[model samples]
Target chain A: MKYTIFPGCLISYRFPEYEKSAKLILQKLEVEFIPVDSFSCCGSQVLESIDDEKMVLLNARNLAIAQELDIGSIITLCGSCTHILKKSLIKLHDNKILKRINKKLRLIGLKFFPKKKIEIIHIAEFLNKKEIFQKFQNLVVKKLEINIAVQNPCMVLRPSSISNLELKDRKIIRNLLTSTGITASSYRYMNRCCGGTMLAFDDSIAKDLGKLRYKELQKSGANILAVGCPNCQLMYSIYQNMLVDDVVPSIFFTQLLGLSIGFSQKDMEIDKNINTEIISNILNNSIKNNG
Target chain B: MNECKECGACTNACPLNEYDENYIVYKIFFGPEKDFKLWTRCCSCFLCEENCPYGLNPREEIFKIRRNSDRSNIPPRIIKYYENIKRTGFVFNIDEYVNEERIEYGLVKLNLDRIKSEVNKLFNI
Candidate 1:
């Protein structure tokens, strides 16, 4: 019912629509949450690769803040943030590392007491656990009948260990969409990286890799691409114009659910997305047909 | 015998390998030598690490080599992210633009001063 919302750094700054849509939908669902506004970055895969120690310490500080807020769980929409924060929380089990980090935090009057019962969950996990789909079904005024191809971000679903891949958030998302009369499908490279991590290092490779996956997603004949990770949305939506024709534009999975639950396109900030026209048309046609 | 098994599993499973197999093979052999533009093609998917029969972490191996070998070769954007975090205590500094967006969406402007001081003390930056 209540959790601390960690917007991470990138989503809060670069893509505030994710925060806006999530806030609006969660408000409608009556999920009580206070934003972790001062939280630092999650030490993304790039930082982890460069300096594992700093990555652990940085994320430990964020978790300490959650403990400060006295919340048992924190919900994050960015897959990379979820992965990094969850993985770092798991690393705190080592008493030696905990002591080291606590020593550092003590300098700032912040201390991370290991085993504080803090849970870092992806938004998909949070919604699935809270049965948000049933709430959406209860509140739906208009059902948007659209076929969506879902991109399961690697950080969110793969390597199966640190991430709650066993929970199969993909299935939860599909079920959630279906509850609102929308159908979802998977295309090739659904599990492949969307080049989100590599985008900073190699833009060309990142675009090509996303293009490879988008081309396959195009074949799925789904008009809209639904994704669990903000990075996946960033990859597909940012590169929409350069990608193949009829390339399904990406939106956060929650945005689509918000649409079904009676929020208009403006409420979800669909127009701010790079492929606005395509998504706008899809929404318009759905409204026309249902009306 | 190369501490790598030469199993070619990484080459087979990598997404970038689909773009150029010979280039990846060569990068694996000579590494940090030859043209590294091809080396920059790795997308960090870790699929190769997952599929490697020998349990060798080729992804880390390649990234380690790249990190140690070049200064200028490091991506400017990644360096920018580091600088921003070091100076502002977050990956992104709270600029007027971001502050405006936050206010527009009914979210409060983030006060990074506390986190910034904490980061300064912790990292000695």
Candidate 2:
């Protein structure tokens, strides 16, 4: 369970709670984390779309940092980071690309040898690893009774061919919810894009997509939405106010697990959430019921 | 080897395409070679490729265009993000709020000076 952690731009800046909750849960589970410094952005879709080589270089530099640490496997909290890093890793496997990148790396005193490849594991896949979920499931003192819906971001689930992900991540999220005694709500738009990519280009369109998912979750009786990607959480969480109807609070999957592992509301930074009162109410009600 | 029938099914399935069908349609009709200012609109969601009936990944075509396009015409925010990475070795450079938050999380404050030096040596920035 030992690996290097890559907390991409958003988690490090706008949403450090994901890092905090993740670090706490991973520490409790005895999973060793080696933090790599001097890491850059994931070269998100926008960066990649403008100049593919720059994106590749940025991602490769991050991978090289892990390789320098002698860490065989790397885990990321952001789905976009996981997708971009995994894509870069696969691309670097080509001898020509490796040679080209290594030439640039040599200038920085770094080298990416194709012979020694590193395994890129997303946090979802890391937790889904054989019986690990079961171990966490057994530790839940209070199973959440609120209706929880899961948003399977495109990077985490669909376009499976390029993602290079093998785990049934969406099912794992569902199972994680169900095992923790939380009701897993499934809706038609569960697999739909949250319009995150379009948020920067056309916010109206992004909000439209977010509103669609929000309505579906409401129709399914879900009060809280759990997501694994920071971008997805960012979209739905912010869209709550933009929507006129009842809007469910969106939380990171790690934060959902944090509650079961005994992390308090403050520890998970639930207050910083836009719709913090929703989750706080759920926790308060759970306490009242247990009392 | 010729599987694609140019049915535009990929465009029909794309989430971003729903925002503006003409953008994707324009790309498909006239590959990524032309300087389509709206090229940055593609979110890299890969939905269109997944729904493609011909198994042709239009994303690759877009990527080819992006790779060859001039870097100067991209959005200002994206340019700033790249500059931040080159100068600070971070996409969002450490600020007072970020420093305070890092301390709260029990994480070490990043040595911006050291990181910048290392990045300069690496990226020649």
Candidate 3:
């Protein structure tokens, strides 16, 4: 039951609240984790094209550190981090790649032992585990009745192989949000790409794709958009004000979960969010069911 | 059409195709197309990779093309981001102010000094 938080580059750099909310929930669940800040980037998309081998080597170092620290599970807040780390973990299984990686890893005083078996899981997937889910559901001191439209992480649950989510488990993010006793409804673009990856190359297309989806989200009538990925947060949360007229105020599902678990507004860092004012209004109305 | 099946699933499933009609995903996979600029448009969501009935990875091919393509053809910002990661492990620059902000928010402050040489050996930065 030991875990370590893989606070990815994007979450660590820009969105501290996402990490804070997740840590608070894990703490409340009594799950212990080592705070490992020694690890570097997951080699995100930037390194993948520059040198795919470097990407693998870098992530191998991360996996080696996880194994060194005796971490059983590495909970990631960003989908890309989960995907890259998992992808490298699978690739490092090849004896040849492992040997080459070990050569470099030795310089850094570390080595990859595949037998240790570190599980690289996104927070959404971790929260959706049956035992964890039941524990999380039991902590629900108040059930907010707001209808939430969820946007799933593309990297966290795709390709069916690298992500390791089965067809039935495809709704991990949606299912995790549903536990809050909030109204969970599917929308036309619930599983579509948010073009967050394109921000590296062509940002206009990313914003254009976001505007297209936000327009539909405005029409989805869900009142709030629950997203599990930081890239989606950048689209539907950070850029919501500039993208649409009537913003839906995209929020991390954990932030909403923290409140359902009896945490107050300050606990969730409600003021840090761009659409905090609107969210406060929604929270004001949502708590009427608690009493 | 040789192997793409032109099933239109990839294009239809693509978020970018909705805005730009010329952004046909299968055609890029079908290839003989020369515009690396068009290849830069993908968000790398893997939707097309998942959507393709034949399981061919257009996203991977596009990146292969991007890797082999002339450096001048690629966008400047992406190159800068790649360079930054090579120099510093993280994409965005980390400074005292950034770490101070994290601690103020009740999160752990990052110390890159520990992993600097490790990532340097990996990236040879």
Candidate 4:
């Protein structure tokens, strides 16, 4: 199946490895990705504070561009983008205030018909498809054999619309890890937020929340925290170092998957990771313990 | 509305009261002056809204509080950041911190000038 890719801001600029590995994994499964041209930010965190009309217009414009390309579904790498776009789409379809905003969008020559259905799936969800998972299973040349805690931040779970699918996401990750002969330990608060909402407004609170999760995962005896979204990864990484006394490390789930598939840590760009040394130790320990 | 009994069950159950004993949900429901400061701490987890004796969404009430409060009371930096976003369409100066090492990993750099122009045109700023 083909999907129009929306890299969002963070993945496009800050965490490109996510986009790279995402594209690689999707291609390995033969899923076609059509990049949407002339796309703008999905107004993730900004929309919550700014005027609702502006958020609707910006997201609708992107959706309009997707419609222009005749691609109905847009896959996103960032959970924030997915939540924002999905919420905006729902509002555009259900609220008249948003309808007027779409009309205003037409003044800019960007006509947005809210009736068009645009499916926004997180990259993790797209990869979780049985066929894709099977292909991913076949590609694993080396076993990860590591115990990792999965952190699903609030942006991924809030708004309920997008996160409702995440229950299955937890299962998908478990299944993929087991298939690769990895020991994936499920821990409590797996679905808790990383306190990212307060990152900008209150860094101390965000740090405290991050430290809380770090301690929880540390107690779980997981060496690394595997995540799907970059924002979550960034927050966890920050907490692991600046807040939690550098006790545990955080890595993107795709990075771990890429490594287990015999992709070099450098090839996966894992070497550039701030927590690379700790992660390396974990991988080494997992391998040594398994043998 | 039958789902909500107006028993103020959610108000009593709220954790916000622990932070500020006077920060009760009934005060929000009855008082004319809405103190959003009490509600801003809400995680938006919808636990109170979901558990409401009445189907009333307490989260919506918190949102109303946020809307009614003086925008100036918001952290100046966050306010400025939002203004920049609304005016420029891009998160302002986002490219300056785009770690160069990230570019080598096949990460796409956003055309901030293009995003700024688009947002400016849309907002007529």
- Model-by-model lDDT, in order? 0.73, 0.72, 0.82, 0.66
Off by over 4 Å in 4: A95-99, A161-172, A284-291, B2-33, B44-56, B96-103
Q: Which ten residues in a row have the lowest lDDT in candidate 3 chain A?
A: A172-181
Best by TM-score: 3
Rank candidates, DockQ, best first.
3, 1, 2, 4
Give interface RMSD, every candidate, in order: 2.3, 2.6, 1.3, 3.1
| TM-score of chain B taken alone, candidate 1 | 0.70
Once superposed on the true structure, which residue ranges of model 1 sit more than 4 Å away at CA? A130-133, A167-170, A243-246, B1-10, B23-41, B52-57, B60-73
Interface DockQ of candidate 3: 0.74
DockQ of each candidate relative to the true complex: 0.46, 0.46, 0.74, 0.35
Residue A25, candidate 1: Cα error in Å is 2.4
> How high is each candidate's TM-score?
0.88, 0.89, 0.96, 0.85
Residue pair clashes in candidate 2? none
Q: Candidate 3: which pairs clash? A: none
Candidate 2 off by > 4 Å: A165-169, A243-245, B19-35, B70-73
lDDT of 4 by residue, A205-226 (tens): 5666666667678788776777
Q: Candidate 1 at residue A54, lDDT?
A: 76
Residue B23's lDDT within candidate 4 is 60
- Model 1's CAPRI class is acceptable
Write the residue-wise lDDT of candidate 2 on A3-107 in tens digits: 767777777777888878877877777766776666666767755665566667767877887788877888778777888888888889888888878788777
Better of 2 and 3 by DockQ: 3
Alpha-carbon deviation at A228 in model 3, angstroms: 0.7
